[model samples]
Target: MSAPPLNPKAGLRAALLLLLCAVALVSITAAPAAGAGPGSPDSRRGDRTVVRTEQGLVRGLSHGSYTTFDGIPYAAPPTGPLRWRAPVPATAWQGVRDATRPAERCVQMPAPGASGVTGSEDCLYLDVTVPTAEPAAGKRPVMVWMHGGAFLGGSGSDYNAGRLSVQGDAVVVTVNYRLGIFGYFGHPGLGAAPPFGLADQQAALRWVRANAVRFGGDPRSVTLFGESAGALGICAHLTSPTAAGLFQRAVLQSGSCLTSFPRGALAPGTPAYEPFAPEAEVQMVGTRAARQLGCTEGGNEEVLACLRGRSTDRLATAQLMQSFNRPAFGNGLLPEAPARALASGRFHRLPVMLGTNHDEMRMFVGLSLAAFPIRTEGDYRARLTEAFGAAAPAVEARYRAADHPSPALAWAAVLTDRSFTCTTLAAGRTIAEHAPGLSLHGYEFDDPHAPVLAGLPANPDFPYGAAHGFEMPFLFTPFPTERPLDEAQRTLSDRMVAYWTAFARTGNPNSTDAPPWPALRMSSPHAPSVQSLAPEPGGIHPVDAYATHQCSFWDRLSR
Candidate 1:
């Protein structure tokens, strides 16, 4: 599982020791990435697919309505000596570079049934999708996406943004940043280092700011959007001073500044989850991790030198990669925890849309049900006690097992309300409270019959209604689903594309084609209006998120 190997670079000042050890990693040209479907090297290419970028010219694939350019490096590969430092500008290349295929994903934890860790450190690349009709410069909006894989796995190329580009008339840039230990690891030798993955995202935005016009996009109209870990990364930027002016609008789906999990949310006895960690705590963990790696013979610089020289096979173990999934605060990139900053009104003043799925935790609970079944009332009550502690009875009273079809479903609902739905609503409310004049919108993807997605093993008893990440295919075309969308779901997908693109273009999601989505009013005497998104007739309407999700009760419990 060790994959934290140093990527080798040519013609750059990589650490001296790395130059000797990792030369083989760079010199040997590998075969094309497996599963590089569609726009493979065998795909058709033409002059129309070629575009000049800040670095050089790259040729993509032409798909009539849209064009795609993949594997364009946004930053110098964070390999060898440059592993943990801030991303450096990509080196310019000569002639036309072939960009019809994607690079390796950042080193990651293995997939659901993989043999070992997959991906490479030399993976800081981005992909662009441009509508052919809007090829004129500065004519369309720009969307920068950050993929969601708990910050451990996922690649920008995995998502095909053609539907969003052609239908929404926007230029979409999906980016790949460092992941897991390679991205989030911290050490005392590094004095208050920013999360490399987040820094890579900003670097990509800066790339967009400088190069969007060439791709028929308006630089000033950049919209930052993502789901799950990607959405959480956007939350960090909402409060980051370095990220100021990098984007104008933000859309966070199923994650927020306040998103945290209680104990036993994932499995029985699992510790609570917080997306961000203190720098000191991360540094301490890093130091301990370094010692465990047998790099404890000297001071910070010497230990760092030893660590940098280690082979990827030595560092990419399951333990090391999973240990540093949380980003750290108390640094220039983040002055404080994003939740603290958001609560104190320190985030960027811009239009924001944040929401969660109606059955957000079904995906999680369904995945773990095989190992830790919650098949009975006793099982559900024990979980409630572990998560809610002294308030278990009250929470149970509010979300009783008899009210649901099964105890497992009841447990999923409790987690959805406590961990994701309520936290997202709270973050949205606090934003409204701070900037009453600014646009703040909330939503819930309320479709109870969404297709099984993301390769989850299915269970007949537990239906995975609109769960975490089920909304992705609607936003990006060709997302992996067990089956294609139906007539009504396809219509809903088109409307959602319009809503998302309209929000990107004008900071409002409403259009003449769909129902009106009003901004939330946190100060109102009654509950705020949160748009509920679904495929059924009369489904795409507003609901009282605070009241429906029982947020007031959860708020009091937290206090």
Candidate 2:
């Protein structure tokens, strides 16, 4: 049957509906199964593993190849009077606590069609996964992961660290911090700092320092890594004075200090986005939120009390949560925006690996097409005009729609180049320029046939093509995907695991066995080298990232 013509209002409504559906789908994918504890039944009976933290003793579950300790509290829950305040250390407990089950995720807006919020306010937990077999004499390198959900949703427990632990020979820790309003809200009542979320992450790192030895990990060799918002969190930590010495190395995937979205890049009417907000702006939003919740009738303390008294359900709605999404600056946590700090050479001089996907914006643009159809040449031009303003004509000329399979693909390419690809390359160049002594590396995951994640509807014409978060499965096992990797993909996955772990162990990604990943050197005569990671034979090679992404054009536009 022929499809009917697209109506603007109907398309928007449908898009909104699909967006909600997408969130709900993600929620389902993210939720853990009914009684799957960290340890399996055999591990519970045969190989009981217990570790002692500063707080208390905890028992973990043992699988055949790895051991997992889940639901270990690193800090007290940010609840009641503690809302919007810095995370406090977890109080010591008596007796061995069960670390088999994952803790509730921090309070967050329920996914659309969900019955209620899926987590608790008291949710500052960290999970550790280590290889079952002990290393000869040296403690393994530790990789602490922070999950990404635009800083609004996501939990540490949702990811399974078995593969990274066993294959990479590393101890992996995943953390759950406060999210959305509970995590990032700033106001007159709240003292200066980045946000509770960033604070919670620091607390988690401290916990790892104190307890990593128990899990066969070297506290001094910890590597902090994350994708998207998580990577952005790493960016903040790199610039944060208080975060000095927390970790020795860092890895940022698909996000950088300079990451920003132009207006209408996501959808027809979506506004431009900045990851961080000034304290004053966040305070204004908090004040307005307080008024909306009927908490504005008293002094700052009284108003804070009123806000604290509100039910989690009331405060965790989607709109309220998104209102506090950006972390506030002008505090101890971040004295200035991270990008500005990086540009001024104010960030820490440490070995870093940062990169984005080959098609970072395809997932976003593909999801929005149902609601804001861009089916024709004119439609594509209109979107360019909305996003690039006066430069739209030039952008259209540069990324001609006739070159791509469809208008949607063309738009996605344009957004990807302008937003993620160029911005990340620029960030690497800036870092190389400022920290000339630091070893910096860049990469692009270009597995064109990477598995599609669960929940995103399949579109034949517009393949995901190594879109945002697609590279996650290579590092972590059992990521929700439509299909598992084949033999060739598995080989690539193994190589990547080796590269990541080698980098974590020694501030450099190249090892004797794997392909050599060149560093981003300021003195290099050639354009900066970025390793290409793909499944095909000879797929992993260095490319001139600047020329590939046409970063010169973006640099000019940005200036």
Candidate 3:
């Protein structure tokens, strides 16, 4: 992770990851309506699309190829006394509410380089984008997106759904849920269920089920997808009993049920992180946070009330908010750790698309170079020792810096294999073993020259080749990058959008135009086939992801 903004490079990777995730979330925004008046050449041919939701009637804008309804409340705002609680039904409205603007993002800490805390407590809103070309009869498939910010920050409005909607010909929904302390804080006073942020996402799905047809979407064909933290949330939902029947398909990008980082994986000395925290641990953190904010004068209930009364600004600080980053498991929301659940064959039997980037750890490792420079082979070995302890020798021997351009790249490769690439492949193999009949597809986004989404100072030695979250730009258009996509990259982007949308349309991602994407074959468990997504010709081909990432080596060490 990059350091704070004051340090410029501080938490640069972490900050850039958050920003890239946010931009990827928003890149689905489609272009403006082609023409003006009804009689004009670019007119939508009919009146503005109006959908009568349970709360009220909403008027959305037409973008010629697609229509968008922004800032529609999925549930009542979780503000004031409602803070840290499961979302409640939104109140009905009187008039046709203009759904033109996106609602405020949920309360969140300032991302690195941000001026200050941004977003609001009243942020249980979602945005819907549908194809302008009317469906023949049946409703189009629905895709509900969860934005990523490591459970600390990010909003649904950051993504644009135009390309996904217009090109994929599906209904796309981006959601805003509670974040940071306001979203996942746990206390003894609260019940043993409901990670507020996850609950908020569940509530959004319920809203889509109830109102999808209003916007020409099929509730039964819903697909839940996200990147980084968002993907982790989807992983939780895959195993969440409350999430049953909410989504028919799922896609996990970068993060998964088994996705975790060793201590000092992102930045040297930073604590290791797991997506889920035990309820007791989270409650302990909450108690400490409450006391720090002077809310410990009374009983648990009283303390919660006091904390709820605190201003959003007061609770949403970088230091304070980061404390509440993990969602508590062992509750109604998550009965057990998702990885354990998957191991025991307890996850929902739904079609899944899971994968990671080639150089997943380079982004994080690159950012920490200045503060925790790995200048020599000795520096690299020291980091391995710090992270792996007894396994450091084996890890260092497996990844020699002489094989890489520099020590930093060698360290990044080690982290990538252990933390991301191998873990994701392991997850795929486990899923294949457990859910043999399910349509499971694995992919590796391998555009070595892929545009860097997160702004980092150029390094001569460390080239972030297909780094973490880099594949997002290809799926969603207009992501903030150093330069625009060339013809070949654009072709790759179109192919990705097709594969994604095709998967949403059906469980299978193969289309007539795109190359054949084979499902994960169980026969090759140790070398499971995965599609290599890249820009070059024949780039999108099957490769043994497990063998490529040397997952067998990590599996032995982990055992």
- Cα lDDT listed for each candidate: 0.82, 0.82, 0.80
Model 2 / residue 138 / CA error / Å: 0.7
lDDT tens digits by residue: candidate 2, 73-96: 998878877777788888999988
Error of 1 at 217 (Å): 0.7
C-alpha RMSD between model 3 and the true structure: 3.7
RMSD values, in order shown: 7.8, 4.6, 3.7
Candidate 1 per-residue lDDT over residues 205-310, each given as its tens digit: 9999999988889999999999888899999999999999999999999899999988767766456789998999888878878988899987999999999988
- Please provide TM-scores, in order, for all candidate models, with all chains considered together: 0.91, 0.93, 0.92
**How far off is residue 203 in model 1, in Å?**
0.6
Q: After superposition, how far is residue 362 of candidate 1 from its true place, in Å?
A: 0.3
User: Pairing residues by index, what is the TM-score of model 1?
Assistant: 0.91
Question: Which candidate leads in TM-score?
Answer: 2
Cα lDDT tens digits, model 3, 473-558, are 78666565777788999999999889988899898899887789989885666554799998998998999878877788998999
Worst 10 residues of 3 by lDDT: 35-44
Clashing pairs in 2: 39-61
What is residue 159's positional error in candidate 3, in angstroms? Answer: 1.2
